[model samples]
Target chain A: MKYSPALQGLIEALRCLPGVGPKSAQRMALHLLERDREGAVELSQRLQVAVDRIGHCVQCRNLTELEVCEICADTRRDAATICVVETPADVLAVEQSGSYRGRYFVLMGHLSPIDGIGPEDLGLDRFERRVAEEGVAEVILATNPTVEGEATAYYLSDALRSRGVKVSRIAHGVPLGGELEYVDGSTLAHAFSGRRPLE
Target chain B: MKYSPALQGLIEALRCLPGVGPKSAQRMALHLLERDREGAVELSQRLQVAVDRIGHCVQCRNLTELEVCEICADTRRDAATICVVETPADVLAVEQSGSYRGRYFVLMGHLSPIDGIGPEDLGLDRFERRVAEEGVAEVILATNPTVEGEATAYYLSDALRSRGVKVSRIAHGVPLGGELEYVDGSTLAHAFSGRRPLE
Candidate 1:
């Protein structure tokens, strides 16, 4: 159907979002125009503000308005330990868990050779320099358990080990509250192989 | 977690979209910041442009950059037959069906006394005037099947009938390609009651 030029432009722009199709784009456009004009204006202004101000933390590559992220700037966090993660979302997940008190090193993405993403692309050189210069004692590998994550973890382990830092991978086990029967075979195998003796 | 001010604002703004919660808003914000910066800029620009340029069509209340919507301004459509719908989205749906060559009258919303939406709120007075002035022969009620939709349809039917105009409600029956067994009881009942005789 032929929508007005402005409405059509709005719909096309909305389609850029993840999982949003043409129908959803149309619905969103109409809803914004009809009922939530103020909210749409706020969203547009915020989008511009976020794009202009939010940038990667110089210290850990996490999102921040300043030079370094809050976590990296805080003196309370364990400066000697760094958790390596794939994305800023992963940092949020680990923070929500409230179990990890160390700083994070966000890779932004894992090593994807097919996508031409290598160690240089992930700022691994900067990470290595920080580990050595900051006297980090331990490096935690918290990348996803996928093939790419595993490869990146291995590479980071080797790179950090040369700097005299201990490297550890987060345990691969059935998630807390998850039944053993529902756990996939590969995860169960990893859990079994990495089993610790009952204290 | 404590996000940067701009990032937090962006996430909050994203939550204004229908069905988008905090988690999805966060994901969208990060995705736009990390992967699709250009698309985010485009979306923001288009949103501003749409809000600035688009307005309700003077005649049909559908979205338009001009004074009247394209469908309403088209000369080929049957101006005597007006399809009354609850929203601009509904107008698009009818247009896409390709069967209806009639012009549309968008109500923007249905009547709901609880929400303080009365006849005047939906521009019913304007609709009445248009029917008489334009020499409208038929008014097709294409409102949704919800209770409010039914009430609005009934209200319009009565209002138009007093002005000596023919009013017809869109049929409520089993949808095309729907199997009788899988159809809901209410829909099956509607189909049974509205069944047509074989020629």
Candidate 2:
């Protein structure tokens, strides 16, 4: 059941992707070799270029080719308001919503004390300096509603409040399309507690 | 919502894989860029190597770095008995079973007149020549049990019978580990008609 060396190598390499297992890796390798040679070559070249060129944005810690990310560089975006997220993917998600015109800060990961990740690991000190020096008036925490995300938001709120920046967390509640019956207890509780009066 | 040029290219290229849509492609691109840079670089290099080197086997149309595939090159297999399959993936599946010790001929696809695919497209002429010149005794039609596959099998049987070679189609029946009640009606009928008495 062993494939040729080149094919074996390709299959093994493809397994590095998240959720791709041995069977899926083999299928992908065969598919690329059999049907999409040109696309495969293009993918290879692009992968190399991305790996070599893409780096963390200096200002926001999001992935970028330049020193600062596009969001951080755009003068039209509200530099006075910074929305913080756990990963670059989250930055993309928020951008896709198109409701926010502010800049972003990617923590790359949430703090996990058991894993030895702390405020320094998430570049909170640098973020603090950016808030003060760049005259950021508001800091919005948009991290996920998990335990670590909540803990990170709490820590960042405490750390930034002394610097005179208004701190706020994104609302936690039932998702827009989610049925109330299907919504979990904690989320329902949060939604009820955070209810606002109609204007 | 636009990614950098290199990142965008990588994501688009990744979409060429089967079952990978835009969201999965984006997730894969970000995962490779953010978490597994070294693995990403290796995958890129391996993809290039595989694409540059792997080609169809001259004898069986299976993938190989050599002119002939490993199975075709092997001296221990029964060259006189050739198992014909619709795709190279089927060749791997049959090989994994370890029940057949014969050589293989990959048709690459089934006969579909509406799609303009014919016996010539499946390289049946070359296969006929191989059967006559190489002294092949048996030709096993292991194509899938689909409409096009059944038509192809019938065509091959008629064509090869005139050449005095034994042409046999693989049995169509209930699959192993399948329950009788759960099996489809056509497959159950096939199993009933093709049944043999226990020895």
Candidate 3:
């Protein structure tokens, strides 16, 4: 079927996101055109505003409208402790928990050898330099529990260990009330290896 | 979770659209900040452009950036015949088939009662006027096969029958080679009843 090129273009553009597919894209495009004109416009405007105004924080590479991110700029945040995460999304997740009082360093991506993504690709040179110079007492590796996440955690550990920074990965295990059988193989294995003493 | 008010505001605004729930909106908000800044800006610009510029064509009530829609503006399309549809997206569907040579009359909605959407809400008066004045030979009611769609079609048929225009409803049946075993009751019954002479 020969759809209008304009309509097709909109759908294709929407499909660029991580999980959205052609059908979902079509629905989104139509919804934007029909109902949420303002919302769609806001989304588009916010995107451009963010793109033009926002960039990686000079300290942590987190998405920020300023040179230094909100976390880095906050006077109350512990400058001595830095939580290292793979993406800005992870930083958001940590922030949502509202428990961590430390600053953050967003790697912006994980180390995926199969995908040709490595330390250099993530600008780890800058990160290592920051870890050494910034007087950060401890670095918590909060990259996801995927293979790439683990690899990134290890890579960061090796790079920053020489600078005497205490590096640790985020704990991975069965979710609250999750059955052992229901847990994925990788997560289950990580849980077994990283087992802590039960109080 | 203590997200910034501005961030929370943006996410809530995003969830107003159909299919966009809280989680999806949150993900979209993060993606906008992190990866797809330019794309988001473009989308925002397009949304505004579409909302501000595109409106109903004075002649056919189809969506248009100008007073007359692209289909109505095209000299090659048959103005004498008009295909009536419920929404602008429905216009796209018909256009995608590449079969119809006529222009379109977009209702923008249907005769939804529980939702307080009536004939006036769908701009049916404009349709009646267009049919009355314009030399429209035939009106193909291509609304979706739903209750509101059926009622809208019936309403239009009764109104147009007195106005000396050929009014016809689009065919309802199973797709070609669609097995009866897989087909639903209503569709199967419709297929059996509307079955044509075997040549």
Candidate 4:
């Protein structure tokens, strides 16, 4: 016989998570029911609360419960330079690096004409308004290095240049700890093309 | 900046699931928020419902929302033979194989004295009561091949022999699809010792 209705429902519902499959879902459901009911309850409560409370920041379009996200609300951060990224996770990635001191603008997704996504869908109008009205000096394009991400960065650079703001894309190259032999061809090409002369 | 409070809480809670780490938790939480809010809501509702409703079946100690599980309630299944397994998942595994026509008794866990889990914790006394009252003729031990599982099986076999019930353990061998050359020494040894002559 199959699992009881509630157990079956939990397993099926858990499949919505990225990378989770039938076996993993079953394991997770059983693990929770058999050993960690408290954790399951906490997870359920937290998921519900997060879904109910979380929303996009009004100014930067990053995820937040407040109208403005923490980085966007901070006065100590440099407001003149904005780092544009494709998702909220990228904001966290940059923040964890502890190098960027500027605020951020989340595009939410890259331009994909095949998928019907465009500038308006990415809130570029709002971003441009912020740029023109706030006297922003530079915008860094930190979208992924995929084809769609490159196309998005190119489009943004064209748009921002005409608006009189300096636009720069994050560098692509071999990673710091990676060996040359294992570096992908496209990245090696990017490293060669964007090479700098050491003083 | 760190993830917003609600998002952070959701991510942290998601980590309660097995095989999910910080990165996977963030991805799952953000994925649910961005792409599958409906799924997230369903998951939350189902998890809450499952935890609140699901409990061990009174007769078999298997997980179910009712006093007796569907397998136990079904009259067509053989009541004279019982397949004793370690968990509800094992019950499903046996059912899916379409081989066993008998009812099941779930141990919930194996005997591990170091963890202070005893026969009472495994509901062995309840199992014994069923064997005595229900006229059960045979019991199949389908516990895992681990040391604890073997110990549990041996303990159950010894206890069941005195109750006028035929006790048997499922075979330990190289799996149907596995190559014998690559099989572990213990499994190979068990396979050799348990070999039966062709009729």
TM values, all candidates = 0.97, 0.96, 0.87, 0.97
lDDT of each: 0.92, 0.92, 0.77, 0.94
- How do the residues A37-106 of candidate 1 rate in per-residue lDDT, one tens digit apiece? 9999999999999999889899999888999789988999899899999998899889989999989999
lDDT of 1: 0.92
Best by TM-score: 4
Clashing pairs in 1: none
- How do these models rank on DockQ, best leading? 4, 1, 2, 3
* Model 3: colliding residue pairs: A44-B44, A45-B44, A48-B41
Tens-place lDDT per residue, model 4, A35-141, is 99999999999999999999999999988999888888999999999999999999999999998999999998999999999999999977888898999999999
Clashing pairs in 4: none
- Error in Å for residue B65 of model 4: 0.6
Q: If the candidates were sorted by their TM-score against the true structure, best first, what order would they fall in?
A: 4, 1, 2, 3
Compare candidates 2 and 3 on TM-score and give the better one.
2
Question: What is candidate 1's CAPRI-style docking category based on DockQ?
Answer: high
Error of 3 at A150 (Å): 1.1
Clashing pairs in model 2? none
lDDT (Cα, tens digit) per residue for candidate 2, span B66-159: 9988899999999999999988779989999999999999988899999999899899998898898899999999989999989999999988
lDDT of 3 at A191: 83
- Shift of residue A8 alpha carbon in model 1, Å: 0.7
Q: What is the DockQ (computed on Cα atoms) for candidate 3?
A: 0.40
TM value for model 4: 0.97
